[model samples]
Structure formats: structure tokens, C-alpha cells
Target: MSLLDACGAGSSSPATAGGGTTAVLNMPFLEDMQVPDPDIMYEGEGVQVMHAVYDGLAQYKPGTNEPVPLLAESWEISTDQLTYTFKLRPNVKFHDGTIADAASWVAGFKRRAAINQGPAYMVAGIKEAVAKDPTTLVVHLKTPNNAFLHYLACPWHPFAVSPTAVRKHAVGGDLAQKWLQTHDAGTGAYTIKEFVPGNYYLLEKFPGYWGGDVAYDQIRITITPSVSTQELQLQQGQFDVITKGLPIPDVLKYQKNPDYEVPVTLGGTGNAIWINPNKPMFADRKLRQALVQAIDRTPVVQTSYGGLVPVQKGFWIDKLFPPNLDPISDTFDTAPLQALVAKLPDKNVDLAWGADGGAPVQQMAELVQTQLAAVGLNVTVRQLPTAQVFDLANQPQAKRPDLFIDWLGGDALHLDTVLRIMLRTGAKPLNLFSFTYPELDKLMDEAILQPTTDKMNAMYVEATKFVMDQAIFVPLCSQPFPIIARNYLTGIVQDSDLPEVIYADKIGRKLS
Candidate 1:
């Protein structure tokens, strides 16, 4: 059977009109080197390269969080929702001419579990993955999770590789991980033609790809360390696509230019003030509530975000969440904060943040410092690398900060990802807040099992409200993610399930 016949085609982007030509899609890179192994890739550049060269069981529908079948034609969830059976697309072959089947998936999952690197968290819930038959793949989970399918759709995890090719290239039992860094393997639309770490990489379209047509024959990604250089390149028409790192201020400057199309989209990730309850002053729920209420978000949103992003109404970004889930009203009041602050012996706050969130986090922290001062709180701001802040929080209880301004990159499709990563007991080590409540944990677990959307939303609402009452953290603004494209570039999908990712396969130059 043909590849398309094996795996039923899910959806196809509209073919470019007229006649198309080979176009160069230039992308950016922040890291010095991309981890070539898909199971271990966590950085943005690595993810981009992996998605370009690999296909997961599923992928998010373009511009939406809804999961759609990709390598797997369809999947069935058991009554308990712990077992997922996937029907493989039969004709799918990796770039190396090896068939990708249920066995390939099993091998990939086992490899991911064995490698145990940055993206290891993606498969942490899986109890086992087995090939029930040649085309049938069954994955058994430790517990029922509604979002497990969405997890499979994520670019970071469970993409099938050419196990035969991988094994052939394996050295010292490394599963070809070391070799894959400089090579390509998978059934993605593009194959790596050339790779130079910290410099650039080139992708050529795979002719045997079953995912309809790929507009661009080739994609060249250049390493850009500065946003200014990206902006300059965009203005000079040196690059067709700029994949992130250009600031909002620079995006604003290019908004009026006819040469570029600056798309301002709401990202799935959220920024917030993570309060550490282990600290003496913040241990008081009243004090935490007061701090949130006292701070005015208007100026922070206006100045820090340049009024580009919305002042978050609730913890979740509005685009990805149901409207009813947001708080009815977020009121700013100082009386409660003033009274609470007057009673506290220690009013000094150490605000720590990383460069990941860039100027917005720093500006938001400074604004918060000023806001709390009006209520008799003294704030000291500190800046550190992203790694150090997470390291300190993950260390012993005594090492956590009083408060940290940071961004939470939530799963775009489900709220459970946020709750599981930030609020659950085991998540305390990774989260800024070190406290866990039994009642909240119960609500979270129950919400996971809810069979209906209404019931699930109700439980989630209750859980969110419970967290709001505790005031463990303050939800700030959603980051403004703007994509800059040359006006001649066509077939660019501005919205994506993963806010940080932009698929390179769909890009095509406008046919004239």
C-alpha cells in the first residue's frame, strides 16, 4: 500500500497557488549546539530541527491546541483511559528507506526512557509501551490521564525514528545519539542535508513524505545571537522567516513597514510572581492575598509589555482557556495589604528572576517592588541565569527565595500540565512555591478523572479558586509573541499549539 493509504491523511495545508520555486527559510538560534537526539532535545533550536526531521504519532491542528493524527491514523483509549492503542500508518518510511511501524514506536519509546535526558519528563507517566501487533501500538499508563494524547502530540517527545538506521549508526551502545547530532533520521517532511553546530544547518525536502506537498524544497537556519542582526536581515530581505528572539520594541518598529508582516499573537505560556510560602512573611495566606491585591497591574502591563499583551485576568491565558475559568473580577485594593503589612515583622522581599523572560520579568519585578512599597513592604530585586533560579528552588527548603518573578510555560492544550508541574506535591521541587495542600491535590487528581468537559471544568474552576484564595502566586501578563515575516513569504502559519514553535515545512515563497 502507498504511504497515504497506510496512514489515512488527517489534514493538508492549502497548496500554494500558481507555480512555486525553491525558497530559503532563514531561522534563528540562541544555543551554541542543538541536542540531535529527539528524546533529549529541550532547547528551541533542537525542537525546531527535530520537528522538521521527525513525525510524532500526532500533531496539533495548525493555529489550535486540538491534537490531530499524524503518523498514527487514529487512537483508541481504554475505558480506564490508561491504555492507548494507536494504528500505525503502514507505508511511512524514514529518510534512510526503513519502514516506521509499531516496532519503531516501541523502540523509540524504550530509547527515550533509557536515554533519560531533558525531555524525559514527557514520558514520566508511562508505565509501559508495547507493540500489540505489526500496526497496532499499545501504551499502558500508570494512571488515567486525559492529556496523555496531547503529550504524544508534543514535538519534544515520542517521535518515531528509523530504528534500523539508528541501530546501524549506534556506537558504544549510545543508540546513534552521538552520530544523530550530525546526521538525520526520520519520516519528517525535511531531512538534514548539512549541519554545523553553533553556525547553521540546512534541510532538504523528503520526496517520499506522505504529508501532501512541502512548499519549500530547502530551509536554511542561521545562528543569530543578536535581535538587531535578525531585524537588519529581515529589513534587508536576507531572510524570509525570523524564528524568535526579536523583541517587541523591534517588532513595533517593523509593524508599519510594507516589507514585513508582524503578527502579534498571544502565547500559551504565562508570567507570574511565584511566592515561596516557606518564607516567614509569605507563610500567611492573608499576607499573600494582600500582596496580590495591593499591586496595580495596569502600569506593569503598559510599560513592561508596552501594552502589547493583556493583563492576565487569571492564572491561565485567555486564548487557551475557557472564559468562565477566569476570575469574575481581579480587584486592586491597598487597605488589606496595608493592614497586613503593618502586622508583619519582616517586610523585605527578595525578587529573583532569570533572563529567559527578558525585560518584561525585570520590569514587572521593579514595578511590583514599587507597588508593595506603598503597602509598607521593602523589595530587593536580583537577576540570575535561568539555571541558577531553578537550582535554588529545587534545593533544600532553606535555599528558596521569598518571591521570584518568572514565566511558566504551560502545555497549550491542557491546564493539567500547569497544575501537575506547579501545584502537585511532587512538583514542589520544580516549582517556586514549596507548599502543597491536600485539598488542592485531591481536586487536581479528581479533575483528571472527570469523564465530561463540564465536570472537569467545574473541578478545575474549584481548584483554581482554591489556589486564588491561598494566593500562593500572582498571575501577571501573558508574553506577547510576535512573528516577523517578509511580505512575499506565503503559507506561514502564525498560530501553533506550541507557542514557541513554528513549523518550517509549511513555508513557501509567494508564486508570482
Candidate 2:
């Protein structure tokens, strides 16, 4: 059967229009989103929606790490790099018609800190956030952090919330958390029109948005868990775009098809096998090293990902690492691993992949299981929901899986995020195993404080080398996220800094 026939094209009304001021774009997600609250969401799926409905003080330039003026028109850093003063953009209004000013930004920062949820650490370094004037915001950090702007540009960065909305909706001092679940208080180009968890989310263009031109009048995202169903829908004109969940084979087919536009770009995301050090089986450093050496990543990348993803050479993504640094070699003798596995009282190891990962992730997990099994270890593969996989960090050592394969990346392209978020002691959710290295953490802490990029890169290189030696994680493959959209859709550029997320406001229907 042809690939189109295999996808099972079904009949449905088109979700996109060729031309009109009231253009609508329909997209699908394979996973359910958490609450739409900006301060609380840390997942990739939710970030895509939040990015559309919220604007930060600064935003990264599309396809680059450089932070550009967004809500904040401009900013200046103090000589010590500990203080930042931002000049707020004028006449910007939140979706609720409240003015987005310095005071509102300060309130938002305070709210984020007070709530202290998943992505709060992005602003934890700030000692104080004060509005010097209606249009001026002065922030004081405990120490100098050159990457502070990049942090603000991150997808999970704290965003400006409408203080007016907060006050009106505050119930028992929840900071509008309950109201924000199905609502928006942001100053972005889009506003949340409807939110139904595990079903559908609707976003409509804000009429009062300060940002120049709003694109699609409405963004309709439905939760379609099945990739095959999504494929069928996309072919049948039910889904204008399939942002995630389509398997690599189907994606490649879309790339060849004339009716679809498949744009592929590096997602700034990569998968890694995280070893739970707290587990008795992985407690020994030698066993960790043995496991790392036993499994080859080439087959995993080529077979599971169809050679679309490159095998990770180091802990950091290719862009963040210094060019001169030597790549981590995959060549290792498996004899030691085989011997170690044979000696273990319990050779059985539990391996898990995040549920959101879909087919590619499961295939990678199964391949790894086979590789480890070949070295005498009995590996059991399990699929856990993303939230449960994240919960493993807080679970008792006995309750956690021996090893879990998960996507390890950051909202920004900075090495600080790559190291800090995935390996830092307190960075939760993504830091699945709660892996901590005082030396590595110290290096990262120092790296961010460096006055120059070269100095920071040098420090990060040392930290990467240290982590490689420790074998806390088995570096897997990094793949470019593919977005398959109808041919008429325009402005579907992927933000390099925000991995897998596109600027919803920039997307417009192509003129007929």
C-alpha cells in the first residue's frame, strides 16, 4: 500500500483558510497539556501555547540565542553585572486590557517566586525585583550572572501577568493560579479563548495587542493521541498542521509529498539515558561506566530515529560546546561491562521512556534494552507518563526505575541551561534521577558568572568533561523536530532557543 493509503485518509472539513482576516489554524498534540498558567507550566506542549499567549521582558531572536527587546524596549546592565534596569515598552496592554508596565512585571516576578513551581529556578537568582518607576524595572541579583538575559528569553521564563486580573481573581492568596488555568493575563498577541484539558484549546488573536501584526485570528489545538490518526487527519484536511507525534517514516513521506511543507530544524533538544545513582544497582561508579560503555548509540540513532537524529557526542548540544574541545569517543571495550553484569546478584534493570516520546522514544528504549541484554543484563522496558517520570526525582531510591531515557534540553540555547536544568541539584522534573555533582555544579555556577563568553565556554567545557568521566548519563541522539503543515501555511519558523515551539503570532495564512 502507498504511504498515503497506510495513513488511512479520512473525510473532514478543512481546518485552515487560504485567505481572510479571520484565518484559523488547526494543530494537534499527542499529549495532554498541564494548566495554561505561565508560572507553573514547564512541559514542552504547554510552552507552545503559553508562548503564543504571553510575552516576556525579553525574547530570543528566532533561530538564535540572542535576546531582543520584547515587553522591555531596552535594558542596561550595571558594571558589576548584578543589576539590570529595563525600560518597559509603552502602551502595551494585557489581553484583559490592563497596562503591562514595570510594576506589573515586578508583581509577576514576585508571583513566580511566591508560587515557586517547576520553572521558578529561572528567576531564583534574583535577590530583588523592584519598579523604579512606572516604565522602569530594576532587578538585583545575588551574584553576577551573564546568562540572566538568556534566562528571561527562555520559554519557561517568568512573564508579565496582569496585576489587575490577579487582584480580581485572587482566592485565598493563590496568586490567580486557579483563574489562570483556563484564562490568560499576558501581553502577547493571542488570548486564551477556551481551555479544556485532555481535549482542546482555543486561542484567538488579541485585538488590543501592541505587537504590530497578529497572524491567525484563532489557533485551534486538539489532543489527538494517535499519530496514525493525526496523519489521516492531516491528509484529509482536518488538521492544518501536525506539530508532534508523527513517526519519522511518516514525516519523511510528508517531506516528499507536494501538498505538505515539512520544515526540519534542530530542536535544541536531545535524549539521554539517566542513571539513578541512588539505586543500589547503579550506586557503583564502575557499573555506571560499564553500562555506558556497553551500549552503542549509533544503532539507536540510525535504527530508531531513521538516521534523522545524530548521536550525541557530549552532554551539551553541538552548538553550545566549544569547537576546539575533543568530542567524547564512543569506542569502549564491552568485556568489562559483560563481566560486571554477570557478577550482579540482580541483573534485571528497569528502563523507562517518557510517554510523550511516542514511537521513537519507545524504539530507542527497546534498542537500549537489547544492547544491555546482550551484555548479560536482563533489561525490562517500561513507558511512564512524563509527569510520573519527572516525579521519580522525588521518589525513594527503591521506587525509582534503575534507568530512564528522557529528552534533556533547555528553553534557551545556553550551556548554563543545558547543565543547570538537567544536572543541577535542585532543578526538578527534567533532572529525573536527581543527579548531583558538587564539582560540576560549582563549575556551572562559576561559568554563568564569567564576564566573557569565551571564559564561560571554557568553564562549561571543563564541567562537560567532568560529567563525561562520571558516566551519570549515557548521551543518546539529538534530532531536529519536524513540523508538517499544509502547503498554504506561512511563517512556521522554529525558534532555536525554544526547542519544538513556533511563534504562533508570526504564522499567517498564505495569500491565494
Candidate 3:
């Protein structure tokens, strides 16, 4: 059935709030989510759904990267940092009426490892996961990892699932992969009521949720691809909020409206241009450096995002890594770039941007294209859906775009997340350029084993500087996290670890 037919979406009235009535939160998805299963889904949109339907061992404290207790109330780490023991909360039950405990977590980890999808790397270091007892779970890693706890807190990390349900639904040893695509077996506050791909997903409050007294009774998420349509629906009280794809102009417009609450903060995400070194034109180090130095980022940031997002200062986002390192300049001389471009046999370059990025990213690409053309090159700009852009990573080097512009943030606040996921060898999906260096990979490997925060940060600094000097990835600007919601919607918190995800359980209606 269609979303409108199932949810009565044609109603003109806004969702009812307070006065002991069902509080439904209406939101829109800029693109259809891949799947709600935590083990397989890694994208931000799907992760949002997973956050509502699943509970991890730990979660980042609201507005901070610090790992705090969730399903696992308290945890202890070995001095060597190779072993971790977690104490699960008592009497927790999944949406399917199954108990959640040490065994359930162990099974979940095993299932994730066996499935071997994109997010499986998060748990690859697991040497063994054993149930010390009903409430105590012990995990041993192959090597010391300082970011282990942070990985557990990531939105894409392994979450507890119903072992009984998993076994019962297993078809030909599929580990319930098919069953989980449209269903949920988590212990979180919400359960998937209906999952209609490319249409809508309806999440109802799980009556047996361990967390007592959730705010919204239902969360209705419809696939609304157009940001303008989402804005209209929100204005007409059809949609309560537009989480993603709202342009900066509309964001500023809503900020002036008293009826809407627009919370804008410095997000962990940063926009960058990834130059494919495999391309013959960019193979030369001088040409790559010239390409990066050609663009003046000041106008690009101002014209595209209306000066809302600041030009990026470093390879990583502000305060995410240590300061005092050299900053990337906003402006550069194009004379050297022009000289270098004159020598190139092929000046034609294919530049692509994510369509899900909306209009700002396309504008940024056009501005860059203009800047590059002034330096004696022919640039062709193309807009592709975000999923198709990710698929480019798997394509052969000959088939990939010469340059890709997109914004990326770590799964967690740890420096390893950015270093290892985007630049490391064979990092799929996000590593569109397929840029890899053995020394860089080894440095990150050493950084993860550092004993103290200072030492770890120092290693990361060295790594960041090394990558910056390579000039393959050009930093553009910092993306500000903005959530436009109705004034009555309260408790909207943004986590630094996962900026794009809004925790549904934390949301509440402001009673009149």
C-alpha cells in the first residue's frame, strides 16, 4: 500500500500534541533509506532509523563525543586496552518479546561479523566475544585499540538483536538478513510498524521498551525528495520538520519566523574535493598541487552557502583535532596553475557532486568549475544521486569521475574514523578517489595503538599534515548542522558523533 493511503497523509490538520493524545512526529527523507538493519546500513539516513529501533552497548552523551551507558550500564577496559567487559542492564526486552542480555549481544556481534558488510569493519578487531554471565559480556580484541569504546558508541556499530528471532527467521543460513530488511528486533524505544521502500516508514512506540515513557507515540517518515515540497508541507502543517536537504536561504527564512525553531551549530562534517590520482591528468604531483591552489574558497563558500559555512581551516573539522597546525589558505595565485594547465595534453575534467546535497553543493561545483576554467581547463559538471556517487568507489578507475565534491563526517568523533575510513587503502564508498599510501596507512595503524589521548592526538596530527601535503583531497568548508522544526517540538538534541541523526526517543512536545 502507498504511504498516503496507509497513514491518512492527506489530512490537512497538523499532528496532535499534548492533552493525552497520540503525539505523532511528521518528518521527511530527502532520499529513500537503504534498510533499517543496523548491521548492514551505514548511510546517515538509514542510521537515523536504526537509532530509533536499536540499542547499542554505549551511546555518545548528548552534544558530546564521550561514550556513556545505554544498554550496557557500565563497562571496564583492561589496562592493555585489548579486553572489554560490559555489564548489561537488567530486564531489557526486544520489540519481539525476546530477552536482551550477554548472549544476545554475543550473537549480534557474530552475526555482524558473518554477514561481512560495510559496517562489519567496525567489529573486525574482535578476537572473541563471550558471555561471562547472563548480564556480563566480555570482548577481546586482536590488538590494542584506543577507539574501541568510541566505535561501540557509533551509530553504525553492532547492536543487540533477538537471538531467537534471528535463528527462527534464518533461511538457508542467511542469518535473517532478508527478514531484518523490513523488520526490527531491537530493544530501543520504537519498533518498525511498516517499512515500504521508496515510500514511507512508520515507527510505533514499543510497549515493552526498556526506556520508560517515550515522548512521541509514532514517527511518520515519508520520502519527500524535493526540499521545496518539504518546506511547503511543513508550512502547511503537513510535515512537522525538514531534517535534511533544506537550503541555506530557507534555513535563514525559517530562523526569522517565530513559529519555527532553527537550531544551527558547527557540525563535524566538511566539504572537500577528491581528485583521483589514477587519472592521467592528476598523476603528476605538481598538477595536483596546482589544481588545489587554483581555487579561491572564500567566494565558493560565500556564494554557495550564503557565508553560513565557514571555509575549512584544516583537513579535519575545527576542535576535532589539535590546533596550531598549518591552516589551508582560502585564496591562491592562479598564475602557476595556468602554467601547469598549459602543459597538459588533456585539460578536459569530469567533476561530479551528490544530488542529495541539494543546490548548494552544485553551486559550489559550478564555482569551482569557473575558477578552474580561468586556469585553462575544460570542466564538465554532473549531478548524481548520493547512492550512485558512492557506487563510483567500486567502479574501475577508468570509469570514475576525475573529481568528486561531497561532504563527509566520521562515524564517531575519533580521528581514526576520518583517517582510516576516507583515506586508508580500500576504504569503500567514501573513498571515491581511491587514493592510498602505505606510509599513511601505517601511521594510522600506529595512531590507533597510542596509550594516551595526547600521544594519540599527536600521531593523528602528523598523519593529517602528511595527507594535507599530498594535495589529493582539497578542503572546502565546514557544514553547519541545522534542524528546522515546529516551535512546539522540544528536546531536539544533536550529537557530535552522528550529526545527521536525530534521536527520536529524546524528542517531546512542548505542552501548552
1-512 per-residue lDDT for model 1 (tens digits): 33321221101111222335344566666544455677766543456778889899987776667788888999898888889999988888899888888988888888888887655656777898898887899999887777787677765657888899888999999999988888877899999999888788888889998676787677777777666786665555455666565655666787887756777766566678888888888888888887778777778777877768767776676645686567635568899989988887887888877655665677888888888887888889988554565456468766666888877655436777677667777563355555678898898788877777788888889888888898877777767767777676666664355554666677655544
Question: Residues 298-351, candidate 2, lDDT per residue (tens digit)?
Answer: 888788777777777766666556435737676766898999888889888999
Residue 232 of model 1, lDDT score: 61
For all candidates, what are the clash counts? Answer: 0, 0, 0
* Cα-based TM-score, every candidate: 0.85, 0.93, 0.94
lDDT rank order: 3, 2, 1
Q: Name the best candidate (by TM-score).
A: 3
Q: What clash count does candidate 3 reach?
A: 0
lDDT of 3 by residue, 153-195 (tens): 8878789889998988989999888999999889988999999
Model 1 TM-score?
A: 0.85
Off by over 4 Å in 2: 1-22
Residue 289 error, candidate 2, Å? 0.7
Worst 10 residues of 2 by lDDT: 8-17
Could you tell me the TM-score of candidate 3? 0.94
